[model samples]
Target: MGRPSDIPVWRHIGEAPCPPSGQERVTIAIVGAGPVGLAMALEFGRRGHQVLLLNRPDFISAGSKAICFSKRSLDIFDRLGVGDAIVEKGVSWNVGKVFWGDRPDPVYQFDMLPVKEQKRPGFLNIPQYHVEDILFDAASTLSSIDMRFGHEVTNVLPDDDGVDLEVRTSLNSYKVRADWVIACDGSRSPIRSMLGLEFEGRIFEDNFLIADIRMKGDHPSERWFWFDPPFNPGQSALMHKQPDDIWRLDFQLGWNIDRKAAVAPENVEPLVRAMLGPDVEFSREWYSIYTFQCRRIERFLHGHVIFAGDSAHLVSPFGARGCNGGFADIDNLGWKLDLILRGEAPASFLETYDEEAIVTADENIRNSTRSTDFITPKSETSRAFRDAVLELAQDFPFARPFVNSGRLSTAISYPDSGINTPDMDRWVGGVAPGSPVIDVPIGNRWLLDRLGNRFVVLADGWQGPAPDGVEIIDVGIAAETLQLIRRRFDFSPGAACLIRPDQYVAARWRTPTPALVSDALRRARGLA
Candidate 1:
């Protein structure tokens, strides 16, 4: 056994877990080195906690899965130190066109970011591998994060205090003790199975083909989805542009087709040519046939061990919710975990993580299930209804809401979150309490840049000293930014908002007293 050459920080198979006095005992041990786990490690590290990342494979995830990153994910990456690079390397797109039948034009087009003033784009199209590399590189530089590739978790023993993990590397085994173990394992979760947990939901009958090809073409930087196109008739198709002149094209193949033949070169070649025109030249980079399932464990937390990302829940890839939702899990859990570890919050706080995150999961699964039904009609009556909706969507504005082209991923809001202290004043046409704070520009700096990763007070014309532990925004430096803030928050002279560490609104007031802010902070921290 020897130290891994790739990562200088960790011993792949050379040594077992450190002794009681050994330096390897970490505050958090995250299983799975995928993007979610990597970000999870970085998040804890950023909050001044030590994390050990166990990656089963040697960082070789195939097929560029989960290409689209949403704004919430990008915003999180900004704090993690990889946002600018990803935005520069990926194709930034906000417009989506949905085409139905043989129309050379779309039935109707939608814009993901109608605001046009946010710091990040509505979506960034880049290979998931690129995101992993960037996140890993960032995590490696931090002294608090130790990433071990090629390490598998063979056994897990949980107790009232913490969990003991048995990790198996290529040629050796090690036992590690962690105060907390967060499993970011993929859908076929070994951690979930090892714990005797199961995901309860339906598995859709239809299958889809993913053809990722490299080519040079004039395709605009936008998302295009087609229903029953001439090339791929009687089925749905989606097209997206990625970095390095790569394109992702997905075709819905009905149930009962030969999975092997569907991905064959001869069969895939015709589909690509038909969609991209007869004279288009391209080479296949990767081909995959996938059957999607929408399922989630009834509970995400099992005492000291918690499941996250694809391990806890899975949704059809239609809404790009797969990765974005995982990022959401990291954002919600990191601060709470940090607080609980520092003895700043009660262990009961983690229950809110279970409740809030499940809210997000249920939202994503419901949309994924509906999108699957619309894209792949199971019955003739369903097919007719889908067609009629699309036809009307082309001409009628109201019908457009019925047209569901895999409704793109967006950040989730917990309107009824346990942490929220309801509005003390009437509000309308603004970001709601318990929803994520809207991103805006204030003078030369973005609002999110000012927010950082801490609990804060966003004040507009409030005349009071800053509360203890909570930072005050005191914004509106520039004239335009001031106006934008006032409109976005619907504020008066003494207006203020209490925002949680994850940039979620906890409470707001048209006018506030010092006692109210303190109570809100305590409640948001799960102490009240």
Candidate 2:
């Protein structure tokens, strides 16, 4: 068959067992055009490696999936140069209200864990579609990257030198060859199952229904979790405000109910009324019922084939960790691929991808799982404990933290990653030394200002040249930003930190001389 205008032309490499004949070879074959896959493709292409991005033609769909982007995830987008567009169209929410067991007033009215400037913008609620569009657009501009919209992967076969892949489109089957294959195909990932990787986790007995509604109500845009919801005892609903006055409502479906019957207008209208009371007008825009299961792949990689995003780990969306966790996977895998492809590092450098991410993925799973349990307790004892704790929260402010059904924190630090030292005294406000969030001001500049380039090391005390290849800033903070930092973080003028490309603190020291800062940079880059 004659090649279509959009059909990718392949060039041949040495004989490989998987693909008998392929005209083209690329460094990597990334499956799925979702946010995670696009992120990986963007990073690889920007680093001067040949990349192929493939997805089934039917993959694109309307409706927003995830709406919240954490600082850690946003930081990655910043590096990709698409973060500003995402932030521009999204709503920033810092204060989340938590109600305890049918209480009229929220027991916990606020949390500021991932503040933008400590006292400013924190988390933003932008639809997942907007983020994907930005990343996809950025990837499309790179000549090194070839994006195939209708392509579907039939098989991935790894050989001694690289991986062989079979892709099927409408008119023909194409054999493609790549040095590595990264699968971001999602939770029910065919590639992961094909690899015989085990996904271990319990499927929750409960189901939740999410609907986007155009409701004129008094609901504040801030996240609101109704514990012990009146509509259904032992269950709750989460409400988030999206762009264009659309409200995203998530309701817990009681076990044994026919999932289809619950979404009928007859059944849904009453629940909305009960939750909104008599003084609201609303109509459903879109709706879905999801049964969440917390699961993670036993291994992040098998030979040259690797897993990421929902393909590698699945989590409850309680803290917006699901896609964000996958985004983190892309960030971690991106630079490492650059290093290995450039012959600057050994392939073993890629091993840390599994080490740091799998551990972080498991942590995210655990945190989201606990949030699910707190909101929907399965056993009598746990229910009683949950109730008693909420009851006590009425009288005691100390017990208020228990009402946190959502683990809303801007930073998820890997304190144990050899890159972070716990004894570092620079961290204040109980900041995890490993997960670095800094505040830098230069002529009204703020922390996270101009951060999307690469790993940065902040040297406050040392008046010396930074390492040969890293970005260094002598953060000269204005008095107001400094005051804001003092209120938000505990850092002295002499402290310095080695931040990773993704903005997490690789290492820090209380009294960092040039020598110590240099060593930290070396250690962070695995040079030490």
**Strongest candidate by TM-score:** 1
- Name the regions of candidate 1 deviating beyond 4 angstroms: 1-24
Q: For candidate 1, what is the TM-score? A: 0.95
**Clash pairs for candidate 1:** none
For candidate 1, write residues 1-528 as lDDT tens digits: 243354323212223342343324567999988889988998998777889888776544656489999988999999777899889899999999999879998886888887868899999999888888788778878998887777788998899999999887667677888989999988988989999997899989988999999999889999999999999999999999999989999999889999999999999989999999999999998888989899999998899998889998999998899999999998999999888998989999999999999999999999989988998887999989999999898789989878888778888999998889988689886777789988999888899888998999898877556578777878756467788888887776788998988899898888877888888888999999
How displaced is residue 152 in candidate 2, in Å? Answer: 0.5
Best by lDDT: 1
C-alpha local distance difference test of each model: 0.86, 0.73
Pairs with steric clashes in candidate 2: 10-23, 10-24, 11-23, 11-24, 12-23, 79-452, 436-505
In candidate 2 the C-alpha lDDT for residue 478 amounts to: 48
Q: Which ten residues in a row have the lowest lDDT in candidate 1?
A: 7-16
